[model samples]
Target: MTQQKVALVTGGNRGIGKEIVKKLIEKDNAVIFTYRSNAKEAEDLIAEFESTGIRIKALKLDVSKIEEFESFSESINLILNEWQVTGIDSLVNNAGIGFFVPFEEATAAQFDEMLNVHFKGPFFLTQKLLSSINDNASIVNISSTATRVALPGFSVYAAMKSAMETISLYQSKELGARKIRSNSILPGPVATDFSGGAVRDIEDINSRIAQQHALGRVGLPKDIASAVAFLCSEDSAWIDGQAIEVSGGYM
Candidate 1:
């Protein structure tokens, strides 16, 4: 019997994270996902996937808090044991909060917040979880198109994602010894409840974003989720240290 894959997804209760969890489950991966504080939404996600015969575990995690990652690592180990897996086969660093402050107007605290969540958090969390991540496992960092295109309010946010992109290259180079692969997915504007859901709820902003896509439509959670599924599968095994932009051909 082929061993089933296990994935650890951060911020898996809503938006792109939720869709990633759903798709991974459908792909037969047992998922141990994280949500910051939404116990109700987390519960709903687990309930939604019940009876799939794929185990689902949700833990409260604030990716900004690097102090808790050691304990988080312990929790992951216990969950992996419960799932009868020695280590997770994939790690999707998908937890994030949006910051819309412009560079000159942004406060030091705001910049720090972006760093803690978007860059520092994932860096340290993965370091702590390295021992529990199996050899040949894939690491998917959720980046943004902001890294490529300059948007007015996303200076600090995009800078942090650029930092993550640099880290992905190093992760691929160093972890290659263990056959582990690291990559980043840069998605263009997507309609989700992130950043107050302007792209999802406000028609003006939604249409504006949709028009930017070469496909003539804004992205949905499932769109990015599908890319993640591909990256986590054997089809992407030969692909590593790459930043794949899944933006519906947005320019």
Candidate 2:
């Protein structure tokens, strides 16, 4: 009998992360996801999905805190042991925050937070989880199209995301001996809560964003989620260290 494949997605409580978790479950993999807070929502999702007989687990993880990575690894180790998993098949570093502060007004704290979540968190988390990753395992880092196209008021956030893209390449190289692959997905404007306030809820801004996309609409959570699913599967085994832009052809 084949062993079940296991995947861990950070920030999997909502938005793109949630969608990714759903798709992975659909593909018949046992999924363990992390959320910083929102215990009720996390528990509700697990309860709802568990009814379908899928293996879904949720844990609280603050990715911005580097000091917690070791503990996070311990938790994962415990889960692996309980599940009898020889190694984790995939890791999705999808937890992140978006800030719209203008460059001049961006404070050190804001920049630091962005850097910690987008770049530092993934870097160290992957490091801590390296030993537990299966050979030929895939790592997917969520990034932003803002890294490629210049966006006003997103200078710091974009820079940090860009750094992750670069790190993804290096990670792929370093993990090659272990047959581990790492790649990044850069999504364009998506209808998610990342836009503070009611912008995502507002029809005007939504329409504008949709019109800006060459596909005639902004991306949905499933749009990016599908790409992530593809990368995590064997269909993309030969693809590594690449930054795939799921931006609907945004310039």
Candidate 3:
């Protein structure tokens, strides 16, 4: 009999994070995910999957607070106990906040928030959760293609994502003895509610962004989520320390 695999994703209540939860569940994996303050959205997602009879748990987590990671680890252990699993098989660092202010106008608060959410949060979360991840497990970091492209308003956010990519390479190397594979997925502009839904709600803005992509459209949550599912599966066992750009050929 094949045992069920467990996945942990941050900010799984909406956007690409929510879609990742859905795809992982569709793949027949149990999931424990986190959200910041969206209780209504989280509850709706949990209720949506209640009929499937698979394990699902969502908790409020602020990734910026590294001080809380120890307590968070305890909570994860409790979830694992309830799910009858000793360790999670996959971890997705997808929780984040968006900052679109131009670099010159970027405030200190915005810069620090971006740093903590995009870089420090994932770095420490994975470190604190290492003991709970099984051997040969997968870790996927959610990054942005802005790292390659010089987007004006995305300076801080893109820089932190770039740091995450670098951290992923080191994680893959250090965790190699345990066969843990770490990778990053860089998505082009997605038409989610992120950044106040500028891409999704404004037709002109969306068109401008879409024009940069060969696909002629901005991506959807499903577009990025599908890539996440692939990286978490054993099918990507040999793939590690790589940043895969799922941009539809966006320059």
- Judged by lDDT, which candidate is best? 3
Extract clashing residue pairs from model 2: none
Q: What are the clash counts of all predictions, listed in order?
A: 0, 0, 0
| Model 2 per-residue lDDT tens digits across residues 46-117 | 987876878888989999998998888898889999998897999999998876899999999998999889
Q: What tens digits encode model 1's per-residue C-alpha lDDT throughout 1-251?
A: 67789999999999999999999998989899999999999999898867766699999999999888988888998988787777999999999999578778999899999999999999999998999999999999999999999999999999999999999999999999999999999999999988999999999999988888899999999999999989998889999999999999887
Please list all clashing residue pairs in model 3, or write none if there are none.
Answer: none
- Model 2, residue 242: displacement in angstroms? 0.2
Kindly give the stretch of ten consecutive residues in candidate 1 with the minimal lDDT sum.
45-54
How much RMSD separates candidate 2 from the native structure?
1.0
Candidate 1: Cα lDDT at 131: 97
My TM-score estimates for the predictions, one after another, are 0.98, 0.97, 0.98
Q: Write the per-residue lDDT of candidate 3 for residues 1-251, one digit (tens) a residue.
A: 67799999999999999999999999989999999998999999999978878789998899999998999999999989887787999999999988578978989998889999999999999999999999999999999999999978899899999999999999999999999999999999999999999999999999998998998889999999999999999899999999999989896
Model 1 quality (TM-score): 0.98
Total colliding residue pairs, candidate 1: 0
Displacement of residue 113 (Cα, Å) in model 3 is: 0.9
Give Cα distance to truth, residue 34, candidate 1, Å.
0.2
Residue 107 of model 2 has an lDDT of: 97
TM-score of 2: 0.97
Q: Estimate the overall C-alpha local distance difference test score of candidate 2.
A: 0.90
